[model samples]
Target: MHKPNQTKQATARGRGAGYNPDIRFDRVSRASFDDGWDMVEDLPVLRTQVREESAKTIISTNRSPDLSFDQSINPYRGCEHGCIYCFARPSHAFLGLSPGLDFETQLTVKPNAAMLLEKALRNPRYTPKTIAIGTNTDPYQPIEKTREIMREILGVLSDFNHPLAIVTKGTLIGRDIDLLAPMAAKGLLRVGISVTTLDPEVSRKLEPRVPNPAARLRVIRALSDAGIPVRVMISPVIPALTDHEVEAIVAAAKDAGAVAASSILLRLPREVAPLFRDWLATHYPDRAARIMNRVRELHGGKDYDPTFGKRMTGQGVWAELQHQRFKQASARYGLDRRLPPLRTDLFAVPPQAGDQMALF
Candidate 1:
C-alpha cells in the first residue's frame, strides 16, 4: 500500500475533498503545518491511480435487514465520483487509504470478477436470486468506459440467465443497452439512476466527477426507451441545499420515462461526516451550519445513527416531511408503481466448451 503525503490542504481541481483525512486504523498519524515557506502552491496535480485487485470471490452476501438485496457485486473498490456524502468512503479506510481524497483518487479494479461470478453461478447448490450491482460503489464509473469489467460481469449473468439489478450515477450504462435490453425483455434486468440534485452548479460541487443532472436524465430516457425498466433514485437529499428539489427531480425522472422513484436522506457516517462538513464550509459556508443542524436533527441529534431502519430514512419531523413529499410527488407523476420482480426460475447455467453433452 503506497501512502501518499497528506501534509498539505489545498483544493485539487475536479476533486470534492480539499484534503485527506487520517486513516482511522493507522497507529501513526500525520498533520500539516506551515513552514513559513509558502509551499502550498508547489503541490502537484492529483491524478487517479488504478490498482488491479484479484478477488477470490465475486458475489458478496450481506445480512442487513434494511437492504432490499442480500447479494451484490462491486466491480471496483473506491469510486472516482467524488461525492463527499458517500457512505462507501469509510470502506476505503480498510484498504489502508484515507476515506477523503484517497477514496476518489486511488481506485482498485477487479479484473477477475466475471470469471469468479461464472464459477459462483455454476455451483450446483447455488440458488438463484436477484444480484444487485453498484450497491456500494458505482460499477459504471468513468473507468468502466475502458475497463469494461462491468460489461463482462453482465455478460456472465446474461449467459447464466441470472436475474440482476443495477444502481448507478454514470451515463456509461447507456452504452450497454444492447446487453441490458435483451435481459430486460426476459424480465431479468432493472436499473436505478441516482439523481441527487437537479441544479448543475450544486451537482458539480457536490459530486465533482459525476455526470451532470440533465445528462443523467438523458440516460434514464435512453434506458427506458430501450424497454429497460428504470427507477429514479433521489439519494442523499441534502438538507437546506438540494432537498427542495425532490419533487422536481421525481417529476423530471417520470417525464423521462422512469417507472418508479426512491429517495434516501443524506448520510454522513464515519470519515464522510467531516469530509462533507469541509465541503459545505468551502462551497456553501453561509448555510453550512443550517445544513448540518438539519442533518443532526434527522439522525437523533448526532452526526449519524447507524440503526438500520432509521439510517436510510431519518427519524424526525423534517425527515418524515421529506418522505411525505417524495411519496406525494411520486404519486402525482405516476412514478410510484413497483417494477415487476425479475425471474429467478429462468436461471440456468449454460454449458461450457468442455462440458459433457446430455443425451436422451
Candidate 2:
C-alpha cells in the first residue's frame, strides 16, 4: 500500500530562492491557510547534515557513449552548491532522501577516497584512462574546505601520474592549483568551469550557492595564467531565459583566457522536471510555461530526452539554432580550440613494502 502524503511548509530561511519539491517522495510542502499562513511563515534555520560514507571502491566506470571519459570519482554524494537545475539531484532519491532541500542540506563524504584510489591504481590489470572528477557533484563544494577529501584524492592521482579532468563551478578549485598546475604541465589534467548566466540576480536564484559569473571568469583567468588549461562551460543553457547570453558568455570566457568552450542544453530528468517547473514558477512565473513548452519542443514533447546524442544537444529547429549560435560564437571569439589530452602513459604505482627497486 502507498503511504499517506505528508506536507511541510517552506520558510524563508530553509527554502532556496526558487524552492521546489522533490517528485520522488510522498512528502511535500504547501502553504496552510488554517492559521493565517503567518504561523508557518518563519521557521527555525535549516542546518546542513554531513554523513560519512565508506565506499567499497573509488573508481566508477560508465559506458555512456556521450561522455568523454569512461571512469569517474565523486568524493561527495550530495552537493551543497544547490543548483536548482542540477541533473544530479535525481540521483539522491536512490538513497531514500528527498531531492529537494534534502539534497542540499544532507551530504555524504568518502573519507577514504584517496586510499581507495591508490589501491585501484595499484591493480595489475588496471589500465590507465582519464578519470573524470566532479562529474556528478562539485568536488570543490563549500564542505571541501573543511573535509579536504578532494585534495586527498588529488594527491593520490598526482602521485600515480594519473590523467584526470575536472568540471566545477566552485571557486575553491583555485586552492588546488598547486596540484593541478603541475599535472597540467605534464599533459595529465584539464579543468572545466560551468557558468550559467552573467546576471548575478539570476544566478542567485538559479544556482544560489555557486560563485557568481564574474568570480567564475576570474577562476578561468587564474588557471590559464598558471599554465593550466581551462574550458569554459556555458552549461544547461535555459532556452527562454539565459539562452540569449550564449555568445556573450563565450566571448567573455575567451577574453578571460579560456582555451576552449562548450555547452549543454538544460536537462530535467525524472524528479528534476517537476522541481525545475516549480522553480521556474517561483522565479519566472511569466515565462515558466513558455520555457517548458519550448523545452518539450526540443525533447520530442517530453520534459527531457535520455537518449545519449539528443540528450546533450536536443533536436529540431531551436536546438539547431542554438548549435549554430555556439559554432558561430566559438569561431567569432577564437574559442574553438582543443587542449592537449591528458596523458595516460605516465601512470606508475608507487612501490609497496615488498616491492623490489628498479635497476638504475
Candidate 3:
C-alpha cells in the first residue's frame, strides 16, 4: 500500500498537476523540501518528454458496463492536455510513473499504431465492431501535431472502412476533416468534443493545455458542416466549480450544431483524488471544501465509487439533480436525440499491393 505525501509543490505555469505523487506501486516514497537556500524561482519550466512505443497491438477491449463500446484504441499512453479532472490520469501509474505532472509531461506514443491496427483488422477470425478512439487518452493531444499517429490510425481505419467513435478536446481534429467527412458520409465516424467550462479563466487553470471553450465550439460547427455527427461532452461536471455551467454548455453546444450531448460526473479515482484536491486548494480555495463535500456526498461519503453502473453517473440527491438538469437542458436544446450508430457492415479489408486479382 502506498500513501501520498501531503506537501504540494508550487504550481507550474501552463501545467495542471502541481506535484508528482508517489508511484502507487513503488516500495519507496520521496518528497521535496527547501533547506535554507531558496531556488524555486530558478526552477526550469516543465518540458514535455515523448518516447516512441513499438506496440504489438493497437486495439484494446474492455467489458465495463459503463462504456458504450468494448473495443478501443489509445494511440498514446499519456495525454498532454493536462486537464486536472481527467479520469485517465491514473492509467500512467501502470507504467511505474506518477499520475500527477508526469501524466502530462511524460508521454509514450505508438508510432506503428496504423500498421498494428491494419494487421489486427486483417486477422481471419476478427469481427468488426465500433472501435473507440480517445476513450482513455486524447489521441489528438498536442504531440499529435508532429507525431501524426492519430492521423495515421484514422487513415488505416478509413481504408478498411472501419467504424470508429472519437472523444477529444483537441482542435486538431479539424485538420482531418477530409478523411472524417468521407467516412461520415459512409456512416463510419462520429466525434465527441468535451467542453468542461465556458469560462476561460477556469478552463486555463482546470484543463491548462486544451483549446478554450470557443475553439472547441468552432470544432463542433466545422464537423457538423462536414456532415459528421458531433456530440458535445460536458464531462467531469465538477459540483461547486463547473456544475453551474451545465445548461449553458449544453445550450452553447447545441447552438454550435452539436447533434447530441452527454456528460460524466467528476471522478477522483486513485492518485487523481489528491492531485485534484491540491489543484482546488491552489486555484479555488474558497470553494474547494464545498466542491469536495458535494463530491463525497454523491459518492456516498467517499472520493469515488467504482461501481459499474454508478461510476459514470454517481448517486445521491446532488447526482440526481445534476442528471435532471442535464436531461432537461438536453431536451430543451433538441440534443436529446441520439446519433445513429456507426455501421460495422461496411468494414472490409482492402486489397494490398501484391495481392492476386479476384476472379470475376
Candidate 4:
C-alpha cells in the first residue's frame, strides 16, 4: 500500500511523479498542496514486486579471504531499507527493474527458504559450515516481520546445530533472542549491528527506514546482556560525511557491550553511482561536488573503480589516512580485538525420514 505523504514523508521534487518502470525520482518536502485533480491518484497501483517459490537454489559462493565466512543465504531479493548509498541496489537490474526506488519498494521474497535449506542440509554429501545471513539484503529487513522466512530459516539451522552469523541495520533480530541466545551459549552464533552515524538526523537522512543509531545501540546492549555476542559495524565510512564519528561510535558501542568492530568505505557500483549522486545533490548540495572529487582522487581519477584488490578499501593517500584513523580509534577503545569463533565442529544431520519427532 503506497501511502501518500501526509506531512513527514515528502518526495524530493516537491511534487508527485508519474511512475515509469524505468526511472526513479528523489523525494522532496513541500508545505501545501498543488492541483492536478487527476483520478489516477486514487487508483491503487499494485506496487511492483518480485517473487520466488522453490528450486535447487544456487546461492552465490565466493572465496573472498577478507570476509568472515564462505557460504550464506539470502531469503529475499531487493531490500526495503531505502538507504541511498546501498551497493546492493544494482542487483535488481538483473530482474529487469529499475535499481532506483524500485530497489527498495519492489521486493522479491523467497517463501520456501527454510524448507530448501533443510533439504540441502539433509543430503548425505552435504558438509556443515557456518553460513552467514543478511550479507546482501538484511535478513531481518522490515518485511521479515510478516513473511517469517528468516525466522523459519533460523529454526532449521538451529535444528541442525549449524553455525551462523548475521549482519543487519534492523532492530528485529532482538525478537529472536530465544534462538540466538542459545546458539551463542553453544558457540554457534554471532550478530553484528551496523551503526552508521551517532546523530538521529544524519541516520534518518542516510538510512531512511533503518533503526536510529540510539536504537541500534540499545540492540547491541540487549544482545550482549542476553549472552549473545554482539559486534558493531561502522560501515561505509563516507570520508567527509560520517567518517569523523568513527571514534565516538566505537566508544559508544563498546560501552554498550560490543566486543569487536569493523568498517568499510563507501562503495559506489553500477546503478548506485547515479542514486548516490542524486542523494548527495539533494541532502548536501554544497558539499556534493567536493565529496565526489575526493572519491575520484582515491579511485585514480574516476567516481569509482571496481578493481578487486582495492574495491572495499580504495588505494590513495586519503584512503590510507582514513584506514589509519580507524585502526587508531578502534585500538584506543579496545575494539580491535576479535571475538570467539563460531564453532562448526558441533554440526550434525538433523532428522530421520520416518522421524515424526522431527516435526518439533
Pairwise lDDT winner, candidates 1 and 3:
1
- For each candidate, what TM-score against the reference? 0.97, 0.92, 0.96, 0.86
> What TM-score would candidate 3 get against the native?
0.96
lDDT digits (tens) for residues 186-211 of candidate 2? 99999999999999999988887898
Q: lDDT by residue for model 1 over 1-360, one digit each (tens)?
A: 212345244447898887788898998777765567855367677889999999999999999999989999999999999988999999999999999889999999999999999999999999999999999999999999999999999999999999999999999999999999999999999999999999999999999999999999999999999999999999989999999999999989988999999999999999889888888888999999999999999999999999989999999899989999999999999998987889999999899999899998
Error of 1 at 104 (Å): 0.5
Clashing pairs in 2: none
Model 1, total clashes: 0
**Which regions in candidate 2 have their CA more than 4 angstroms from the true location?**
1-42, 352-360
Judged by lDDT against the true structure, how good is candidate 1? 0.92
Once superposed on the true structure, which residue ranges of model 3 sit more than 4 Å away at CA?
A: 1-11, 38-41
Model 2, C-alpha of 65: deviation from truth (Å): 1.1
The residue-by-residue lDDT of candidate 3 on 1-360, one tens digit each, is: 222542334436788988889888999988655556755555566789999888898889899988889999999988889999888889898998888889998999988999999999999999999999999999889999998989999999999999999999999999999999999999999999999999999999999899999999999999999999999999989998899999999999999999999999999999889989988988899989999999999888999998888888999988999999999999999999988888989989899999999999
CA displacement after TM-score superposition, residue 311 of candidate 4 (Å): 0.7
